[model samples]
Target chain A: MSGFEAATAVKRIGDGRYEADLDGDFGFAEALNGGYLMAVLDRAAVDASPHEHPISTAATFLRPAKPGRAELVVDTRKAGRTAATSLVGLVQDGRPVVEALITTGTLGAAAEPVFAGPAPAVPVPPLEECTSMLPDEGAEGFAGQVDMRFDRSTMGWLDGTPSGRPEIRAWFRLRDGYGPDAVSLALTVDALPPVALNLGSKGWAPTVELTWHMRAVPAPGWLAVHGTGRLLSDGWFDEEVEVWDSTGRLVAQSRQIARVGIGVRK
Target chain B: MSGFEAATAVKRIGDGRYEADLDGDFGFAEALNGGYLMAVLDRAAVDASPHEHPISTAATFLRPAKPGRAELVVDTRKAGRTAATSLVGLVQDGRPVVEALITTGTLGAAAEPVFAGPAPAVPVPPLEECTSMLPDEGAEGFAGQVDMRFDRSTMGWLDGTPSGRPEIRAWFRLRDGYGPDAVSLALTVDALPPVALNLGSKGWAPTVELTWHMRAVPAPGWLAVHGTGRLLSDGWFDEEVEVWDSTGRLVAQSRQIARVGIGVRK
Candidate 1:
């Protein structure tokens, strides 16, 4: 299995129950990324459902998840011919860490959009023209597991000259060669750093709640991730991200409301 | 109590449990609105929590909820000094109809935005120049309970012109004089007609999943609602709505994915 596949792999223990290991590679320092945790929970939902794709997911981050053994409890809410809905809970040490309501359905590989609105205005330069987010010293944990090339314009925060705008655009792909699919799309939608970073904020912005939808089957190659925030007020911010496949088709979309973290000048 | 307050009122039965009457006035024809259902659920979350406002909510509609007596089960997932999260379920006939993850907190009445993006470009004409959605025969059910004045440009769908766009902008408020607040903001964010209407679809478009966030305390009066869709493909469509208070401040935001109703031309 690829690194991502093995990292997110789950073993079925019984009906609607599975055991998984919280891979540290998907974490930042100590806590797991909200998107990475969502991908793991989504794997359980798809395995327990009759459908093949996780069409929509609403995830609430109750607490930060640490690296260790975790259990997933899937409570089937409704199973329908078109789609199935389930409440998948990620529990660690007998306490719920994250809970998600996932709706699964089958997506045709060749299905085309009946109608698509204007794409996001996040144009990226060539891969060579972009700067790698990998640290010069060495890549570890999340940075080592995913390859991200960021658009230079949005990376001013790295140099301490933070752009007042809250937006980030980048090209994302798994370092382990896992191709783009429904499960991978889950991770890709949240691959970019929090949009709050560009708003002159420092420290980690924890996602309070996030909802993402799989719009279509993505094509292979690196995915374009464009994230933007609408408002930042009262120690909270809301971000909307659009993931486009290499073929220029919007594959997945996500919106999350998160804490502003410490050191937010604006 | 006002109509909205009386209709969404819940009687505490026991610890983390409440009973409510699913008012038919919030329904369209036979089924209830997803936002209205969310308001009722939020009421339960707030009642069970030590917080003052429902800050975030992620709702999954398993089945259509009808008007009648329903039981709400609020399971406290996490409670902290700053915020609290609970899993609130609405059960009818012993079956789960809607499940929502609600996070509650207190919002300052005089809080100001640290940073806000440009408002949505859904301009509306003067109230008198706009057309009311109420039928000429007489307003009833949802239309009678809520007053909506639509922008003429987006109302082409009513006359079969079918704007060929996926968007709806309107002015919304309760006819019974219910002032704007966190709970009412829940309904106001989803009060606009489905954006898919302009795409030439007919019949009831049912919401599968919706997540909304309360950004600030709204000033009492009419709210400007702007809704738009990014994609409608493979029997599903995504809608995003922004609700601005009468003071021209963004108060609430919501995004939902629903099954495209039958009769879509393109």
Candidate 2:
């Protein structure tokens, strides 16, 4: 199987119990990406639910999870005509590394919005004009499997030029040839380098908790992600991101709070 | 107990199982408020875990919860040094009404921040300069239990003026003598009138799902709430709200997607 397939693959171990073998391609400093973790949980959540798409998911990162054998214990809270809700736990070493309350529903792939909102401001430039966040040294881990083309105007942090506003606009898609799906949208919502990075923060600002919803099925092409931070204070910052599909549909919305990076307090 | 007390009070019926009487004071029409439902779940989730504060909660509304009685089933997903996570279900009449994943943690009320960022940009007017959202006709239901003073600039929707932007800036506090706590913050995070109202929409916009986090224990005073909507399209819209304490400390942040109000469409 390809790396993305291997990293997100989930096998039904028993009734409501699912297992996945964690591979290193999705790790960051010995820990799996939070979005990747949610994708795995999404697999199990989808497996246990009657629906086909994840409507909403709130994930709490209890601890850093390493790549290895992981188990997802799914508990269906409710199965209804409109939606199905489940509580999934990503357990490792006899402990839950992450837990989520995922609500899933079905959305028609060809569904069209009756009245679509305008595309978010700041037109995305051509891919060549976008800045590649992947290290020039060579992409590794999670970054290797995703293509993120950040709008250059928002990447002032790299030069110590902080944009007074906390925001990041980027174009993103998976590099592994896997088309955008509910799982890829999960990663896309969180895949942006911390928005705080644009506000003069440095280093990795770990997310304490994240909540996201899949509003509609994303069309094939680059997803435009616009993220903005409301408040950056007291060792914490809150970011809200919206993912618009190539077809102009708002596919997903997410909000998260993370700890500030060391020596990079706003 | 007063109405607020009665509405939020939870009784431990057994290990991991708690019950609350669904009072009418917290209701809207024939259904209970989603924020109030989360407040009750927050109480149970916090109690079931060792933590003193609920740091994050993502709740999905499956069906309307009528006023009368409800139950919360708490399942501890993990207990770590920094955070305790659980999956909680709000059940009424033997049917699940709301399902949530709540992460609880102990935040020192007196803890100091090494670095704090700027407060949100909008300058909130004093309580006297703000426009009261509570209908002047007469206070009712959930509106009577909380105070939300919206900024006039963002209240253009009230007079059929679409500022062409989706936003709501307000000052909020509970009407009861009770001060802001983790539970109160839950309500406060969602207390604002839907932001879609600023985009030429009207009437009640019911939230389908909401996720919020408590970054710190709020001080005893009104919270400055700033909400912005990224998209208002099709039959749905998304709103993101950030609550700041009287001391200008960031307290809580939340995001939710809801359908457009009846007779209201883009």
Candidate 3:
């Protein structure tokens, strides 16, 4: 199995139950990446669903998930010819950690969109002009597994020069040679550094809830991710990300509301 | 009780359980407006949570809800000091119709956003210069409950000259004078007409999944609701709406993926 496929692997424990191990490599600090958790839950939902692609998913993060053994329970709500809906919950030690309503459908690879809007408003420069996020010593933890090249203009947060706006643009791919697919797009949506980073907020900005949609079946190559936020108030912020494939087709889109970390450095 | 309050009333029956009647006045033809269903569901989540505001909600419409009776079952996932999360489901005749993960919190009326982005990009015209959706014979169905005025430019679809762009902008408010609140904002987000109408697609577009956030408490008066879509492909389209309060604050935001009605008009 490929690294991503293996990392998100699920074993059927019963008719509606699944077993999985939260990969430690996907963690940031002590908390697992929310996107990784969604990918894990997507595997369980797809295994139990008659549909092939996970088209839409609404996930609520109940608590921080740690790297360890987990159980996925898929409760099929509706199974139809065009689509299927399932409630997939990731549980650890009998407690629900993350719950998601996943809707699956099949997409034709050759079909074109009847109408497509301009790509995400934020423009990203060519890959050669972008800065690589990999450090000279190499990346570790979550960054190590996902190769990313960021638009330098939005990376002012690293040098303490926030853009006074909430936005991030990056090109993403898996280091394990896993090509972008419907399941992996779930991970790609939440893969960018929190938009709050550009708003001068510090520390870990944890995602509370996230909803993503797969617009089309992706073609293999580097995926461009553009994220922007509309509001940051009362310690909360909302981020919207759009993923475009190499063929210039919009592949996926997502929006998430997250808590702004209290730990800030002036 | 006010019209909105009565229309969305829910009675607590047991621990984490409630019952409500789906109001027919909120229906579009025979189908209930997805926003009204959300308002009904939000009432149950608020009643069950210690918090007063439904901060974030991710809902999946399993089936079209009819006017009559329905049951709401709330399963508390976490009740933290800052917020509470619950899995609320609307069931009719022992079958689940709508399921949502609602997160509740308390927002201080005086709290200002730490940093707010520019409001939704789509600009709406002044209400006085706009075209009212109320027919000459007076409003009926969902239109009777929620008053809306559309920007003259976006009303081209009505005259068979579609703008050929997926966009809609309007001013919205409740007819019964309940004013704006977190609960009512639920109804405001999905209140706009489908964006696909401007794309020249015809008939009733059914929303499959919608996720909305309560950004801040409103300041009353009419609300500017701006809706836009990024793509429509393979019979599926996504609409995003932003609700700006009379005081010019963004009170709520939402995005929904819906099926494009197969029946089209030349």
Candidate 4:
């Protein structure tokens, strides 16, 4: 695991229970990044159930996890024939730090076939065609792991131009050689807010919070991300992003809340 | 107004903002009810800006409102030449209660019109046909305001049956005489979870939190709600709901997080 390294090693403590220790690299800043925490939880969800099933997980950031080491525990609350429920907790020093609930099950055998809205008609720019637009300050930290390419539609702090539109569209992929698992897929999906904001403006903005929902897991390959930033008023803004596989399958969706201000990092 | 009588009294504070006292027959429970909040916030978005644009809004539940008095505030964060952004905050006793952000603006001159996939071809059952299938307990609070009919292919909680598959489709409409607006539309859209859960099992569950996003406002009359519940391995579940107009246009989308334990409402 290079770009998609698990910050904490997951250990099954007992039936439906597991633990892990937190690492400092997982911290996006002063605290563990929401995306990092989500990635950890995603791994635990897949481990809890080996079979392939659509999993939906949501987490509320209760407290920030400190550096050094933390523990993760998973408990199976209910397991039905079609669907099962699991609760995971990230703890440090025996105290609960973060908690999440995840659901996974095989796709139903309904007579109706799969139906999805058409993939947005936005064009996908090649990785080499677009400029590398990451946070200048945080760029060094995440560099060489996840590579980003910004098309003309990109907005936010990296570029000084603001389209002022609530929606943003962009193309993204890993540096190469990263396995396309739920955790790796999540890392790429969760890293687009900075790019979305850049698509809106010619500057950089750090995301204060993010929440993601996977409509269905992405196919094995590079990914396309389309994000829309709505309701940016009173120093706060919320964005919804839809991720599509290379073949145009709607894979995952994410929402983020960020506090906006006039500060630039060189 | 009946079910909508309380929400109708809410006074608009300013651009995309409104306020209602937490007192009277409609108290904190009604004000903080997920459906009611979604409706009010939706209306405020339209009130702040009219049909010149299409809007999308999402709310995060911070804390519950106290049953006494409260105020709702909305502000347009970004009003560019084309798209605009608005924020709505529900404040009680001078403290922030529930906060929502909305983005609405004109569809730019279309070089070409595009849509993703077609809507699912689920059948719509008559409202009268599905009423008998509602869960016996707490059926009164829900059935009184909204009439629901479900597609025969889906699964639910009513009829004392354990949830088979984890998805539901239903038609929803106000009882009668509820004029169309943001508030009424919100209430009608917010009321589908219980009915959707009816497809799960005979067990009772309460929504602890709810969030909604709308591509466009629904038509002013009867609406159809299609929802799917993903039960996590933990004792919690989340429901994703999409409300459609009679014409089949996707009107609004919503998600609710709820604790899943069997018990009677106090």
Candidate 5:
């Protein structure tokens, strides 16, 4: 009954429409691993909306599915009290592929903090001594889905060099027994922008493309994330991450655009 | 002599590194929008080397411009061969506030194609031209930077409400802009999200954010962009567009994300 609950399955197809099937091993080798299809469409948009509130999702990836069954259909365009919006689609045999949008609500007083700045002391290190750098080895199949560590002040993973400071900070979670939900905390806050563009580049970086912006949604515990990156000489790279949760709050904010390339000179 | 006069100007050191005085108006709104502060530091990358090679330029904000001045400096960033890459940032007292970074070279070998899917189907129009569509109240303070198009197929302008999938479509641009360099190509090839949340959603969709992999820069052609959206239950909603060119060659490609408020509701 495990193995991502027997290779993912979810039907119901009507009342609120539901359909999802994945059969492939969850350690992802493809067959829909964009953060496990964005945590199965963020748990089918929280089962079509149960609401505790706090949402913000964004997805796009037109094609890339090939394991077996991958269908999802959720609906409900708008609900409002404060806000609510949904849309999910990721069909496989019939076409579609991937498309998402979720935007729950309940936290907008706009108190006026205006971005205080701080949050960057950097230093976590401890996931069994932390190591995994990953600039690509197929992103090491996401090294068993998070728990990553890293911290020497910064720039350690990927060993690339440049730690100048467009930023980089880590410490994520998940891995123990899973179950934090919210689509596994948005798949561990979408793996910190390819580890902050391969440690804020001095050389060698890869991501091709990635984007996340979840404003709020964290409660379960122990998360950190951070990242920053912004290289642009044409090799193109952009990262701006944020996720807090050990009580620091924030929760989520991501933006990644990569196409780096340059690490195979041995 | 175009290539934008080889660009040169940007220096505003009060000591923030590219400083230009502060408090708000951030560096005099980037020295009066000197082409949106040369497209935000023209791909930055400071001390690691690489500079020059951006192909386009345009900016216009006027007024503000006051920062520090020491004749100012401009040195964007660059690195190319077959992957092409560039960057240009500026600031000068008398006149000059440019930002550039136009790269072109990646997508190597594998060719053989001629436009297969999106582009050339135009016709849109319905959703009541987008529920009331407002903005031009005489362009007050510039109305959220201008993004109100309904979509009668590609060129509508801005308003709202439409849902997804019509071969993909939607619009919205200008988180900030002023015009010139074709208005930074209206925020570089606007309209995205697997074609704007699949234009209303029903089938076929994938693009968890892939602005053709961003990194190109240069602008001004106009501004005012578009993208209306919808794609329920499956999750998706996107907005962040701006791309103008008239005689620039790189036509259009905005941005969007949608999957509004999932199930339940009533």
Candidate 6:
């Protein structure tokens, strides 16, 4: 199985609970990424509901997760015609690693827009000119599974230049040929690096809390990720992301508050 | 008591369950405003936790709540050293009106930032020059409780001129003598009219779902609200808000997706 499919796959072990096979493929260093954990949790939520898509998710990181066998437990609170509510938890050794409240619903792919402005004005470079951020060697981590080609315009921090704006835009998709689904859109909304990077912060930015809403089912092709941060304060920052399908529709939108990196010398 | 403090005050009847007093003072027409409901919900969530603030809240509106008696139910999932997780539900007549997952934690008011970008650049006019949105006659309802002075830049839609950009900035605070607090911050984060109004949409814009995080405690003074809508499409629009305190600190941030008015013509 491809890594994205494997990491998000859950087998129903019965009684509103499922067994999730979490591997090292979705981790950064030894800890699993928050988005990946939410994706795993969402699978169970979707399974528990009559709805087809996980519409909204709010996840709080309680403990760092390691690659292992975990339990996906879901509690159905209410099920209505338009939406369903469930509390989903990812547990290891009977301790909660990530807990989320997810609401599932069905969104049509062919819904016409009454009114929609064009995508943000930043243009991406042609495929040949886009800079690939995939790692050079190993296929064991997050960067290895997804192809991220940045626009290079907002990536000036590499050359000691702070773009004076907290924004990053890129073209993204799975390296294993998986198209966008509601579950994968959860990971894609948080797939890019922190927008604080372009504003001169450095090192690993850890997300404290993340909440996202799925607007529509994505069309087949590349997804454009636009991330921006409104505030970067003492040890904290707020980042917002918009995911647009290649067909020019918004698939998902997310906002998160995270810890600023260790040292920001710029 | 002032409208805000009285509406949000919960009587702790027992363990994990409290009684909420809903009143029409926080309403528009017969339905209670979403922000006002969230403000009351945050109050109960903060009181149940050992921490002092409601750091993150993701609320889903399941049913419309009217002015009456309701129950505030709190379910603690994890109580960590720095943070605690609880599922809060507001029920009236044994049906869920709103349910939320709130993470409560401590944030310092006097903490110094290593770095912070400036507040959003759309400056509001001085208090003397600001335009009042309060209804001239009825001194009763949500508009009467909070003082909002608009920048008037995005209000050109009132005169048949669309700014072609979705943005709104205003100065706000409770008309009552209370200063900034966690409960009040929740209301302030969602206090303004929908930002989609500037894009030529009109009438009552209802929030489908909203998620917000408290970054820091606010100092005593008028709060500046900077609002923006990224995309308006498919009869839905997404709004993001940043609330800055008088001391120039980024206190709270929120994002919500709402449907357009009853009808749209362009």
Better of 3 and 6 by TM-score: 3
In model 4, where do residues sit more than 4 Å from their true spots? Answer: A1-8, A21-27, A50-54, A93-96, A107-113, A134-139, A195-211, A234-236, A258-266, B1-143, B147-188, B192-253, B256-266
* Model 3 spans > 4 angstroms off: A263-266, B263-266
Worst 10 residues of 4 chain A by lDDT: A107-116
Interface RMSD of 4: 12.8
lDDT of 2 by residue, A1-266 (tens): 77676788999989999899987677678877888888899988988888898878888887788888988999887787767778788899997788887878787777655444567667777778998876673787777888889888888887888676688888898887786889878888888878888777878888878988888888889888998876665566778788988877789988887877667643
lDDT of 2 at B213: 82
Give the higher-TM-score candidate: 1 or 2: 1
Question: Candidate 6 — what's its lDDT?
Answer: 0.81
Clashes of each: 0, 0, 0, 46, 110, 0
Each candidate's interface RMSD, rounded to one decimal? Answer: 0.9, 3.8, 2.2, 12.8, 16.7, 2.8
| A1-266 per-residue lDDT for model 1 (tens digits) | 76999888899999999999888989888889888899999999999999999999999898899998999999999999999999999999999999999999998888888889887765877788888976572688888888999999999998888788998888899988997889888888777888888889988998888999999999999898999999998898999999989988889999998888778895
lDDT of 6 by residue, B13-124 (tens): 8998999889877778887878888988888888899998888888877777899899999988779776788879999999888888788888887877655667676666
lDDT of 4 at B1: 39
**Predicted candidate 5 versus true structure: per-residue lDDT over A161-227, tens digit per residue:** 6444455566776554554444555666556535434334333343323445454445666677777
Per-candidate fnat, comma-separated: 0.75, 0.35, 0.75, 0.00, 0.02, 0.36
> How does candidate 6 fare on TM-score?
0.90
Model 3 TM-score, all chains together: 0.98
Give the lDDT of residue B54 in candidate 4. 28
Tell me how far the alpha carbon of residue B100 in candidate 2 is from the true structure, in angstroms, after superposition: 1.9
Specify the poorest-scoring 10-residue window by lDDT in model 6 chain A. A132-141
lDDT of each: 0.89, 0.81, 0.89, 0.55, 0.43, 0.81
DockQ for candidate 5, C-alpha atoms = 0.02
Pairing residues by index, what is the TM-score of model 4? 0.54
